[model samples]
Target: MWIVFDLCVEGADGCEGLAIDSTLDHPDAMWVYSQGNWTHSTFATGDPFVYVQLQEYGNVVEEIDSDSLVVRFGFVKNMPTVINSDLEISFGLPENDVVSLKIYDIQGRVIRQILKNKTLNAGYHSFSWSLFDASGEHVPSGIYFIELKALRSGQREVKKLLVVR
Candidate 1:
């Protein structure tokens, strides 16, 4: 599996930076960071836009087995949800699996727990974020993250959300 991450100013000219990683480099920090949680200091000053791409390549043997599980996860239509609004999130699974989804701030703190170890059916599934934290309070405009994980398959994906008031 290869993942690419891009962070830059929205409606701006160039990308601030880019990071690419592969499964072969396991146990090491990839794209985002090497150790601690990602903070605002690591990003550009303006409203940041985040984009991620996941690709999987397999040999003949793996390819045959890969048919059993195809993972297609991301925002609906590859767009971020604006702040103070309901954000639609979607993903596809080839088989039923236990999954968890959460929202985290730039400091890697869990602000909201959308789903936790819940079973989902095979097919396209989606949920909406109300732009509120676990406490039901409105979230401040800033950068936050949406993370989804397939517990059984150990598959994890992350996307950034820029909350503007």
Candidate 2:
């Protein structure tokens, strides 16, 4: 499950894989045991900023030697789906990647490009979008679809937002 995020780091020069040893400056010791493509580890405290090497492919196809990858366990939650003002789209990333947020009409046509190819890091992040379309004019009150796509892995999650004027 953890590997699904790609775990691409920002800048840890010459990193090959996960590690924790006496040489590391981190006080809270950490360890990750891997079997082929899957890994198992534990996090007791503090923000985890570790880098590892990966050969990205498929939706996350990027050839690399070492990437500064730091990740934290996270999820996305939107509040007040039934909205009168702006709608909040809140999500937490496990690593650095391009994220997209869009709204589509009932007919499945994109009405607004709230966010396009925005880069973000791990931990929680949120943005508020009022009920409007690309034209900047307010959209009519009805049911709309909010789409969140992680560009790196091509992973997607959707939610329905109801706007009431």
Candidate 3:
């Protein structure tokens, strides 16, 4: 599990804090930031001020390609969202853990398994859903729920998703 120590300054318009690497065996040796739709690799020689592009849905769609970092923790900014054709879900992880994102009906029946026991890095992440079910069929418009679960950490967060299609 990831722990966050708040370090916010008044009138600054944003909060900042030091996030130690919790997932790596050697926290000082390696750091991993996961983001965007594509994957690339980069190695840094020293402390680099990473430029992260924040998408319309939320913060930082592109990751910092580096070996170590002082990251931000416990900042989850999932969109106050509704789904028509797609939905963008964003979350923050404290460490490297197996996570699952699932959609369920109002009656608590599983609709879709977006991420099933998938391992992910500790950082903010964004994922888009096409509003399709597990069998590749479009679901009817109704009230649904989105479940984000960290398997190893035993942390779960549920949000309401309204599909208007």
lDDT of 2 by residue, 134-159 (tens): 99999998888888888996778788
Lowest summed lDDT over 10 consecutive residues: which window, candidate 3?
30-39
- Model 1 local distance difference test score: 0.67
Q: For every model in order, what is the number of clashing pairs? A: 0, 6, 0
lDDT of 3 by residue, 1-165 (tens): 533223333343332323233223333443333332222334434443433322222434457765465444332675655768877788888788898999999999998998899999987788878888989999998999889998898888889878886
TM-score of each: 0.55, 0.53, 0.54
- Candidate 3 colliding pairs: none
| Root mean square deviation (Cα) for candidate 1 | 16.8
The RMSD of every model to the true structure, in order and in angstroms, is: 16.8, 13.3, 17.9
Q: Rate residue 158 of model 1 by lDDT.
A: 88
What residue runs in model 2 are displaced by over 4 Å at the alpha carbon?
1-75
